[model samples]
Target: MDSTDLAADGWEPILAAALLGAERAPPGGPGPLGDLVTEADPGSALLARLALHGIHHLAGLDLAADAMEPVAVREPAGPECPPAAANRLYALLTGGYATRERLREWFDLAAAAGMRPPAWLHQALLRHTQHLPETVGAVAGAELDWLARACGEDPAAAPAASDWTEGTLAGRRAAFADLRARDPEGARMALEAVFRKEKADIREALVGTLWTGLSEADAPFLEACLDDRAGGVREAAQRLLPRLPRSLYASRMAVRATTALVIESKSRLLRSATHELVVTLPEESPALARDGVEPHAWEQRGGGVRAGLLRDILARAPLHAFAGHPPRLWIELALRSEWAEPIVQGLFSAVAREGDPAWARDIADLLAEAYEGKVSGLRRTNELLGRWVQALDLLPEPEWEARVTELIRARKIEAVLAILAKGPDSFSERFSAALIDWLAFVIRGSDDLRRDLAKPYVIGRLGERLWPGEDIAATAAALAARLPEEEGGDRLRQQVMSLAETLELRVAIRREFQP
Candidate 1:
């Protein structure tokens, strides 16, 4: 009998007997299927009929066409990643050794090099990019698309560029941020469309994404947010507005600073020296103070003027307002100002936000000079000195080392090493040699020196960045030679050995990258 005919006529009786355990209800029925079953024992008969029904039903079905849609053929094939690099990526993702940042670097390089990772790696990479949206912009779109298709995934299934409206709140934030970095206008438009309906927390998060591509284009929307019904939403807008130098909030801050502080100049030889900037404070601050300066609940101290308000105004004021004087004059002004701490803090904030290497170096030099021998005299300056040193570190390469070394020559070994650690992994070859020589000298004085050098922050970074070329092997051997023969020395020796390994790995990786 046809499979359909057999099922149409005999399935119910077979099902009933199977459910009844064949003892209570025999497996017989009224058709050929039932007749066939009747030839066997009750239990065996029931099983036989069920098995035949399945086979016949499957044989007559069109499963493939019914279940799956046609996939369009992908265009001209994408290039595959190099074997060595591919191996490295697979090892990095699967080996559990690579940090999140390192994985991102690999993804970025693979994408930038126009190479697609092996299909198996796509899932891992997709998951990785979800947490690191900033890294998404670095990954090549074509590589992502290729990865999705090759893995039997819909080309749109890759998580790197998932829709902003989809996913958990955190996932949506990450996706929104990724899109914002690339297409700020589009992201803004998307956000504004659904923003009013979002919950307070989600609205705050969505507004925060505006920081990615903040410009005058975003000013109007952010300005309107100042009046938002939610306090969190309004506060977020307030915090971000001043960061945009050209924003109206910043302009108002500039006006406030101009109104409150004035720099005076007096003639000195052929040049003009700043006499002092006159700071005018309101007898009592109004609620406007809360707009720029955060409102805090505390008893007021030091009855001169409102220090917090002054700092808030200064920090938000345009850096250009504090310009035109050399860093020395600026520091002098800051040190002597009645609002000295506020002024100093403002200058530091401006230098950091301005991102001028020269300004940063100058500020670092000035602070170092001001605090020179009288380290105990200016206790406050000493506290702020760490921040200035950190600012110096942000300068490119040798500048950080040069300025730091100049300032910290009189500092202790720990102090010098602290500054050194803040710098990039490898200095110029000449600088690396000097540093290695200095480290070797320090090691001679104490076994503990080796412990410090062994730190991943120190040696690991040094190994990665130090391109000592011909001197690497010699330097490694020399460092090892300095280790004392003891338990501590053995650990030191191992640390040095690890440095050598890292250098070798970096060299191999670099060679792979070479065309």
Candidate 2:
């Protein structure tokens, strides 16, 4: 038989003979194959037969079928990215560690320019969205789905509405939060549907998520949660319910608070006619406890729960309840009250949560005093001041900006830096630019460059807005010229130079990505 015929029949016999030995079971048949058998032994002869068969089998293997099917090609939904844009995208992927802000800008520029990223880079962009989906806003839906499918994932795996029940606690919370931002009622319904089956921890977290869209509409549910067996759930309800300006809990708290204080305006003649506003605090009501005015040790130190109950009432009550009563009146009343610290603390909370810029600005002196250490010896004052700076974020952007500049000019460097440390998310473009200009002006006008440049990093960030541009060149050169001969000066100059380089790179990147 030919090698192919022999192979098709069975190569096992030949292999077995090679392994065992032809002496054990010899092939008695004589042919061309038998004549070619080696003289060494049965094993060697079998080896020769197997090698020759393999060669014949491979040589005679079939090449193609009689008829071939046609290949199908589909056009992509979008146009390919321009050569320049594609190169930039490739650099961002391989360059490593581009900031989320920069990545977001790149995605925005590419989409706006109608450039679809190359298919090869799909994996790269998809991998980036794993950590920060916020950057996905600028990425096109078609590209995103295509990339996901290419990565062997379902196109709808990262659905617009996530399956909240399928992930870890943190992951589920994140999903719920995202859903809450998009559809508050839907998120609430999803949580409520599973509430009975959820564990205590999850119930607490789901309740907390209501803060994303807290309103009078949510009051019925939050009020129901007040009776929850879980302390965390009940506490979250207590915290969030009062934030709703028109909620029953807020209204109840406001009524209870207003009743505790009596504000009277009297006109009396000392030298001439003058106005005096008097505020009086009455005996504590046992009913206040039900409105979330429970006494805490922090407040008890001032005197007792009775002495501090007014502050708790003020805190829980909406600031709008006191709309007609001026902030100066409240300040004056707080100064006169036995529970001044708690009262002031409550005012900060009210103004902050209520987002009353007028009241917030009115309390600027109190905030500054606390920050300057004049009013911070007490733990309550220190804590309230901490909250005050945070509440500063809720102030109208322009007002907050003015306050920041005021703080910087007053040389409250630590306090100004503390506000700055809250990050760019806290500062508007107007505030950031103005603050940087203020800092630069402060540095340039100062005779002590050595001291002014002590915090080069902060200076560097503020200087980032102007570089490779003409505006910053003079300031940078001036700073460099004043660099001391010591190590500190050398460090300062290095930072200044680094700031310039960063700005230069940013400018070039902006140009490269321009539509």
Candidate 3:
């Protein structure tokens, strides 16, 4: 009630009686004392009424009602989330450890179930999802645009596409590719018109947009880019040209690759030939420069200029141009030449571009053989391991899993990471079950203090990749239950217990979403 309402409700009269001496005025104003029948004096009655109204006044009895009506939220068209799922959301929101990740799970489940968080959580949910860009589509179907708008966000609206030229370099690059997809010719023309006017970096980035609808159609325009003022632009064109078949740029690269290295084999009678590479650095020319043979003037870090040139040729050359050698033979030759780094980098790029599974496998196999044994060449070993991972990524799913298994047996921590990698987007049930089993063994029921602090990180990365089973939670719980018996075990026990809770909560989350 407002001050006026409080006064009008007989408080003013009671105040008057008190001020003018209640013995004279007889404290008879309508108040909490009105119904009392005892012969209590008016002063005592005043104290009684004062006690009642003081608490009421302190609790906002004098506050006026708000003038504006709150924006009424529309009732969700779909049913509200089950109380259990809502509880799960509240737990994730209020608790620590993989909160956002678990919330992502809840968002997916709720969106798929065609349900929304209870009205009370709408504000919190909006605030959280707004900050997590990855959660954009996870809750898209949750129908929370009205809530977003009430919070001053126009979630239902997208900005109109501005003219590409008017946008920042990054924005233009993003929009140009989209434009290229929609109108390839127009996008090229747009790039061409601004090619001379934009900064070298902008020109280079704009040329990158050609990668979107890259084909022979874009080759002529890209070839013209080879002679652009910016060397970056020329190199960008050089990289893109090889992606288009039968382009003169690719043909030039093929000729370079075919002639760049000669294999001379020395053999004994009735014996296998031992091959050696006859490689020499060719002098630079305008043609080589235009094709980005030396992409930069700075000397290559891992290999010299010649090695860089060879890597470029290998990256762009047609597979058949390298003496018809198998991937292994090619790798052997590169290794013999001591250009292994260049070759690996180049071949990895080419394999990805061509999506040649056979080449990827052979390259991965050769690189992975005695991979960790290169202790003397740690940097080189890491580079090669990374190459193996990339190549394996390109392999078919079953083959990828098989290789992951092999890596796990080698007891590679990197392998474990690859196996337990945040997933369900690509990981299979068989893969997850085996990996989780491996994790329990690897961690040794949280007894592995060497890997102690890392437990949460690994477990949190699960992203719901586990197979349908309550075994992991049970194991963690049992370990947590027993840890207190050991000295200096509280922290480890707590960590293990959290893992158990996360797993159990995940199981419940999955259960809540099931039909």
lDDT of candidates 1 onward, in order = 0.65, 0.63, 0.66
Q: How accurate is candidate 3 locally (lDDT)?
A: 0.66
Clashing pairs in 2: none
Better of 2 and 3 by lDDT: 3
In the predicted model 3, the residue pairs found to clash are none
lDDT of 3 by residue, 42-159 (tens): 6777766656555554555533354235766675656677777777776777775547667776776676676666787776666565443344354543456777755546673322
TM-score of candidate 2 against the unseen true structure: 0.63
Query: After best superposition, candidate 3 residue 382: deviation in angstroms?
Result: 9.1
> Which runs of model 2 end up more than 4 angstroms from their true locations?
1-98, 108-116, 155-194, 259-266, 270-313, 332-341, 364-393, 402-437, 445-482, 485-502
Full candidate order by lDDT, most accurate first? 3, 1, 2
Error of 3 at 60 (Å): 22
The candidate 2 region of ten consecutive residues with least summed lDDT is 63-72
**Per-candidate alpha-carbon RMSD to the true structure:** 8.1, 9.7, 8.1
Judging by TM-score, tell me the better candidate of 1 and 3: 1
Tell me each candidate's TM-score. 0.66, 0.63, 0.64
Q: Which candidate leads in lDDT? A: 3
